[model samples]
Target: MAEASNGFFSAYVDSWDVLQIPRIGGFSGTVELPGSKSIANRALLLAALGTNPDRSCILKRLPDSDDVNVLRNILPALGVSVVAEEQGVRIQADHHRLSASSGEFYVENAGTAMRPLLAVLSALKGSYLIYGNEQMNRRPIGDLAKSLQSLGVEIEASEGGCPPVRVSSDGWKSQEATIQGRTSSQFVSAMLMAAPLSEKEFVLRLEDDPVSKPYIDLTITMMKDFGVQVLRKDYQEFIIPGNQRYLAPEQYEIEGDASAATYFLAAGALPGQGPVRVNGLGRSSIQGDQGFFRILESMGAMVKMGDKYLECSGGSELKALDLDMNAMPDAAMTLATLNLFADGKSSIRNVANLRVKESERIHGLKTELERTGASVEEGSDYLIIQPPSRMKSARFQTYLDHRMAMAFSLVSAGVSIEIEDPGCVRKTYPDYFLDFLKVAQK
Candidate 1:
């Protein structure tokens, strides 16, 4: 078996420094989070699409992470002028067209940048080469390629249906196509983002129910916010009138990241810990990952939520749960660790897509949990976790996945554990351990 492809994307954390987890009774405190990665990438691309030839658009409170940074660096290559500000970036795109006749882009492991850029670039007049890190190249792009081919664009994927993609375009001809969604919702979103620019009315039909369906909703909602309307039929189909254009607003403020909040929220819910309040996301949060707090509340955590904030306090005991997590795969990883503290076994289902992430998450969870003295069972689309009678100290391997590092960090509360390649969290939450330490200090 090969080592997983996810690891440090740039010079930030290449040393693979071993991080020792400090034993703590509990964690509770106020921690402000960075902006939403999903929204920031989408908004940045939309800003480019909607930019007038004469003016620039400002995006505030952008996420400071490697995935989002990929978009920032690549934008200028495509003729988008970017000015780094104190909080975010100022972008001005000239008619949303590439400055050069052809371009080469290295997106590293940022799927958000690669997938969407694939769709948008396919419609422009250019020859483009889009490649990523080994881990990203391993993630499938076939579905998106087939969908683009249906619309009369030329694209070629490697033998495994992965990246190192080559896209050549004069423009597209077809107005309608059907794409499957069993693998990733990003396939659907990529097409939607590029649909309005089609030469004719565009209609995209899904062959099956989309995994991570809520992300598609985020895409549609953000598209509307940029002044392009998509006619949707029950999440199965989308219709975009041809010749429509994205309208960039004067400035857009990004919301707090709900996925990144999972650690602190769970820390507050650890038995005997004080209440933890997270600002930036609340009842009004558009991110589907926010539903994670609801899962915590269901499992006996006391949660108080308002329009802009949420506080969670550990219950007398954490209860085991059996539930589907297809809509929130990233956040659901936290549940695997939380289940370790439950009195009985817990189950998670409808997450087959997790296998294709930065690591084989289901297998990784089973292997690492067993190392900590827990009984684990793996399924094609699910897992069942049986808590250990007493946690055993172990050195957990992060496998280059940020979520893996963060989820396993929770084990330190039960027993002091060591985490290998802990800096991998820089992919999303750069100061995750620092913030966790802050909460633990209280």
Candidate 2:
């Protein structure tokens, strides 16, 4: 009942009221999505790191979102010039010096920025401080910090393994950086990005099985796209040769956001809703979240996949499924809500990491699902849900998490539901509900 902290979104959520989601008989249209945030942010940082002496790197179809905005703003402060162009942004790095003026850099709840930058700034030559909003400061970064420290980087954490990280390094020294994968894969991705800039060849040894291999693969693939080769032996080890530099291409086009596409895909897969086609991410999408459609297919949805588009239809009688969704946590949240339409109980497993996300996702989903007249049971690493005999209208609280607001919107497919803090979608898809309405007409 009490507000979390005085962040920008927190203030905005205080004055917001419940948003009633539109209930439609079916959906039949194509939704054009913005670029992938995961890819966009990674490319932006890579462009900054790989920029030639005075030359520039260009990227097209960048996602215009809060997280991207935060990274765009932070780059310039670190001495990278970001020029807005016709279709994309041009990044100009200081060729003479890798370390620009470094001071306190604030990233508001962007795990992508905070994690990667921690490893990156540690590889630079200046004393830098990185901090984020109240929520981000509470998220774990110790695993990443310790790995960097083992590589001879001077860094400090505030209290726990959380952020407000301070980095003082001459440069990255060549050493075997061992990191655990049980946490977020962002840790591995962060070090991989910074490993190339180290003084000697770098070998990243994995301690445990990684959670999201696709994201790590995405990072490696993009690194290679920029002309750097990473020798990977399964997910256990990654070898990056030292003195390597990132080469910028003429331009790179970002793929559509697969995580964002799951909502519409789910809509189309629902019993009454169907034939929703989403453009952007396709069969060749490098993003792992694209696999979410396979889950839908397993649940009996008819899906069509193309080179650059995906369409879903049918599933008049949806069936429940038990799935391990650790690979696609964000998309899995949409599945959690979509389970409401299933005829029997459903189970989502291997998502204990969800507890440390924007909010306690597992607990939040159970609470909100029960509030909306569903029978739910929560566990340390999983959720079990039994669809209600009939649906009931309820106001679902989002707990200031964007995925919660977006995932819960699926409840409207079966019953009318009101979402609290609807503005929270601005964290990623600002026009989400508006876009949903466009394709949701029968």
Candidate 3:
């Protein structure tokens, strides 16, 4: 890839094999986040499903990240028209045209793209093949495939029950199915989004509590916004009336990415000179990662909230925490690194799902944190971190994971460090280092 400048940053992120982050005084500025990748892709699919000749869905502030782009690029194959505008994207589709379409799609490593796309594609009267990069192919999709198969959708996953999924269906043939949710909530969310496409009432029952449950709520909330209602009995069952279709809203604005906000928030909470504020998410935000601010507060960081913003400043002393982060696994990566600055050992539990994410997060965290002199204990579903007496400058590998790259950047608050494959952040936040430089005082 050719190096391109963002006008602000001197070099292109993609051209860098290793990028050095200097120890900084601290961050003390506001960062305006991009649209939430989770919301943007979900909204994109919903908008495409809901579009008609009478109404076109105009989405505002949709993010221009690799993940969202994957879905955007593939929409045309499904007979949906996606046009880029100055503000966001406009989507339109005819139900008859969409139902009759069929094609191959490559989703890269975006779970948001692959999971939901699988369910939606299966609900249409078409034959489709959906595959992704090597990393995404390693992520399991069997639970979702089995659930769809039970619904009478002919589907087959790879040998290991991973992706490169093939689906052939003339539309829904059954009304009720059971899905195992313990592996991933995306499976559950996928089924929920597709249920409305059935001609009869669809009843979805969960076999176990889903990991990252908040994301399911996000899907339900967005589904309602698109004018589809889902009745739920706790987390175990969802009843989505069939013979219903998504009704596109005139326009929907995506909120700032709360996951991306965690890095700057941690910078403010570190032993710094002053406060750092992140604009885009507040108490009213739908993202579960917004709860990360509460985690910062529990760690003794001074936090203030508004309806659309969160502010944080260093406290007298950072306190360690022993907490379950099942609902906010993405933010948990940031918390894991933040533990390095705490007063004592910290333990983040109930995040074994991290092992199957874009990278094997638990093992990766343990390995990299140890390189920085932190004593880390890795578990099947948890991580225990003991801050070293003295931080060590080390070269950290990102494992092609965006969160890993951003989380380890926090180490610069105490010691100069080098991060490998810095461009991996383009998966979500393309301009991460440039934005980091804005608030970062070297």
Candidate 4:
């Protein structure tokens, strides 16, 4: 079957490098994670659409990861000038909109980029068509489409509720738009970031319980940092007064990803004499995913978290427990890795919300890990993990999911594995291969 399109863009990608991961001691060095993919992509859209009285908008702590880098590289082609520096990225959009005619641009699997960018481009009142690869097409954006429909934006879909979604912007006439927050926080975030430009304020109510409330909260916090005032959170109800234009901040820095820290943290606890230390992250901040460290403790991992650093060192046999991952689904992948070393069965529940994301995380992770000699059981909203009597080496299929590739890399502790599409790690961690090597051999 032909790869799915977002309705317009297309690309042929294959034959990435062959990759290998080895069992290493726990990590002990301070690892600097790339900027938050979540925040970096969101900030980029705001900056691209933002107007400044004097100069272009400057965004900081921009990660050198592939996803952000791709967006930066394609911005100029799409008619926005992006200035790249070690310190940050700057853009001078000058209010020129994202039109459909902008040369062909492929967003890869950066769902954070695809969803919000679609909404922002839709509000620009111009014809702009966005397309991506197989994985990007697989990620569901139908909820986002419905909300855009309510705002008078036009979307054309390909299949599987997939993209090739040709979106055209119309001057937004915001009315009360309710979102189902139980699925993915990105939908809520898309509306929150784009609502500021609409003619009428938006009254967004969460149709059911909000699963990833922290991420939606982070979106608002970042929006405010970039000069958009989103009203306080009232249960599931959120009010954003539209026409509140965004001003590019003199400098905005994206924090290192707390979700990325989970792997190293898990390695520290998984029966290794080596030490693992995560660096360049605030010990405390608004990111709710940071709370995953608490979950690690509950799983019997030895952890020491500080103001700006966290260290995990393996001390005893690890046992798993039922974990609620709704607020931090990104960390769920790491939890899957740690579960393999567990002495007893463990389950991570409430992550049914992850099915329609950049990948079907639960099934993909479970299916792939099973190839590495693990007894895996999948439930609608949870995973029951039973470790194999002994670990064995096997090929690990990454399915183009960066987290899937990284999380499964830990299998090297028990097996010598080959990972296909290992290059996918570039999505968020461009130097992941190098970093994994340094930490493993050290």
Candidate 5:
């Protein structure tokens, strides 16, 4: 397939089997990032839940991606009105309109959609068979299902706790439940979003610390924006009073994706004429991945934080450091690849959850990094990488993960590389390579 050009850089089209990313001298440009996938989906669900005949929620800057589209497309089946506008999407829903409906929903590898939809559907009068693509079925949802089962919702998953979850319930029959947080914070967030639908106060306890606690925090923050309050005790327990419903804001604007900004930030931190600026995310951002710029600063990158933007420039020399990345598992992949430009070996710990993401990320990262002549030590939950004396040009397999396709693009800073399945980025940022080409200089 020929690259698409519109007066600027060429972009890899979906029909292309492989994308050749040439060596770039440096990065220098501003990228206006798309709406965050986490916030977009959460806000979409909340908007739909809060929707009424009189009040239709207008969400601004909602990302147009496969993940967000999954929820957008499925909301109408529950009798919710979702209209796509030039600016964003408008959701109109009434709980009274929701009836006892039964159908199969294909979420297509979107965890944000599958996990939350499971809880929300169970809260409504419905028999839902929520399944996803092959990879999504391989991912676990049993922990979330078990928690809902505790609330008197009949829920079941495939053997080994995978997806294709079947949920049948009239509504919440119990008020108290406990969820194991070790696997995913989405389970807790899902429960919290549905708790307000209960007749009595809902109390939820955590069995363990969640892998991505910031995501839960983001969920609560967005929930509050929708006029729901959740009381929590040090992230261990949560209390959401019943007899409340989300009040859709007249207009809610979603911030840019911080996770996607990691790529540009890492590129700016490379040795080049950099100083790349990513607009729409800044110090006041709610996303945990916004902290990724600080990781670059720790690696000797000059960083500037504004109220609504983050800027980065390469420092004197990049330094390696060991850190626990449980909070920012998504950005850890960029950090792992960034090691190629660092001065020493680096260790990323406490991100075992990567094993169950869109792909087996931990093992996949180890494989691809080693293919590029880097020495990688793979553990059950950690990866230690020693940068090679010299980087090599190699073809990187994306494993059908969006992050994999984007994170490995950093290799273009040092060597010409080929990325397989560049189309995988459609899961989140479809125009990733187009934006990447903006900052890259030959």
Candidate 6:
């Protein structure tokens, strides 16, 4: 695998074979998921902002992915050094300058880079053109651009809020930014990460109810951990004073990704699979997506919860339960898989954010789930799924989103099926398919 600027395992899947795995054995074993790419990126930025002379913060469990590695490379560019600890990052990048060599900065297939860096470059004050890999560029940045513009930053888009985002410096010492609440929290995270560097102390507010409070909680936690003082009056209102210095201590650690844990939990729920116990993040953990386990209990999976371990086993005839995916939209696809096997019908609402960032998740999931014999319907903010009379053999499109590819792959555990872009799972969890295959015979 070729290394990306941030460094985890990153690969491009131009062509892949659609192969079938006959549903065979179930699994009961212990495995660990990679770090939350979201937290890694945020921590990298926070590490850069950390003021404590301590220099190192010990993180318990961290996942490795291309997005997080990009963050590692980023610190040194700004004169910070990131050393890899057993489970976290030790960071110290203090001197930052707008490198005048603004020709073309390329970040491949990284939404994390596209969002936060946009704010970083804007606050650093310079004329810069940010271009991404074809797929990354196609993802919408309009909501972010509009919000950035509202704060008096100049962000010119190619069209439809798609990227090749051109950001010019706003001379103000500091700026107050307002963003649409219904969109991805990445927009707000982007602005907050850069607020420490704004000439004046910054203030940020959301126009609507925030979509992902869990992610926002992560950002705030990382900010404070990295030695930056950030305040939120309510969930909607936040304040970060700029013109302060960014001090990086020697070390920090990233946590395991809870989103990735859903698949393993689901596999454990399969009848006669033994038991699946995944290590890393658990109760009292900072991640909100951890709540997916609760959603599973709602759908019939037996969950054994502990202070630091979540053990699940699949045995009951899954029931249909309506869900609100507004909190954790990234896992909506995983929820769709549970719905596919339900005895009745399940519906998901408040997930319109999928349309803007993912090319065609709703369509991709619906087509593939239906192709596998599940009755499903798609809409702007809702998805309806009716259990299939029988599972069938079908090849599904992944559209480069790892979740899409991995979520649908679950069908293979009980049927003969092929996935068009199985390799796409590497986008987040590089060893997802390979590791999953070891646990489930199907």
**Candidate 3 lDDT, 1-442, residue by residue in tens:** 3333432222534635777776876679888989999999999999988888778888998888999999999888777889878756889885533654578899999999999999988888889999999999999999999999987889989989999999999887888999998889999999998888775789999998889988999999999999899998889999998677889898999999999999999989986444888888888899999999988988888999999899999888899999999999999999999999999999999998999999999999999999989999999999999999999999999999999999999898888888888889989999888889878875
Q: What TM-score should be assigned to candidate 1?
A: 0.95
Q: Name the better of 1 and 6 by lDDT.
A: 1
Distance from true location, Cα of 221 in model 1, Å: 0.7
- For residues 17-107, could you state the per-residue lDDT of candidate 1 as single tens digits? 6766546666778888788899999999999988867767889988779888899999888788888887568888876555656899999
Q: Tell me the lDDT of candidate 2.
A: 0.85
1-442, model 2: which lDDT tens digit per residue?
3332421111234426667654555677889988888998998899988785567888898888888888989887777888889968988787634557468889998898899988888888888989999889999999999998987788989998898889898887756879998889999999999887774788999999999889999999999998788999999999998777788776889999999999999989987667999899898899999999998998989999999999999676778999999999898799988898887999999998899888889999999989767899899999999999888878889887989998988777766667888887887788787787767663
Residue 74 CA error for candidate 6 (Å)?
Answer: 4.3
Scored by lDDT, model 1 comes in at 0.85
What TM value does model 3 have?
0.96
lDDT of candidates 1 onward, in order: 0.85, 0.85, 0.89, 0.73, 0.89, 0.71
The CA root-mean-square deviation of candidate 6, after full C-alpha superposition on the true structure, stands at 4.8
Write one digit per residue (lDDT tens) for candidate 4, span 212-299: 8888888888888777788866648888876777777767777777777777777776765346777766676567877877776666
Candidate 3 local Cα displacement, residue 232, angstroms? 1.4
Q: After best superposition, candidate 3 residue 299: deviation in angstroms?
A: 0.9
Model 1, which residues run further than 4 Å from truth? 1-13, 96-100
lDDT pick, better of 5 and 6: 5
Question: TM-score, each model?
Answer: 0.95, 0.95, 0.96, 0.89, 0.97, 0.89
The reply for model 5, stretches above 4 Å from the true place, is: 3-16, 94-100
Better of 2 and 4 by TM-score: 2
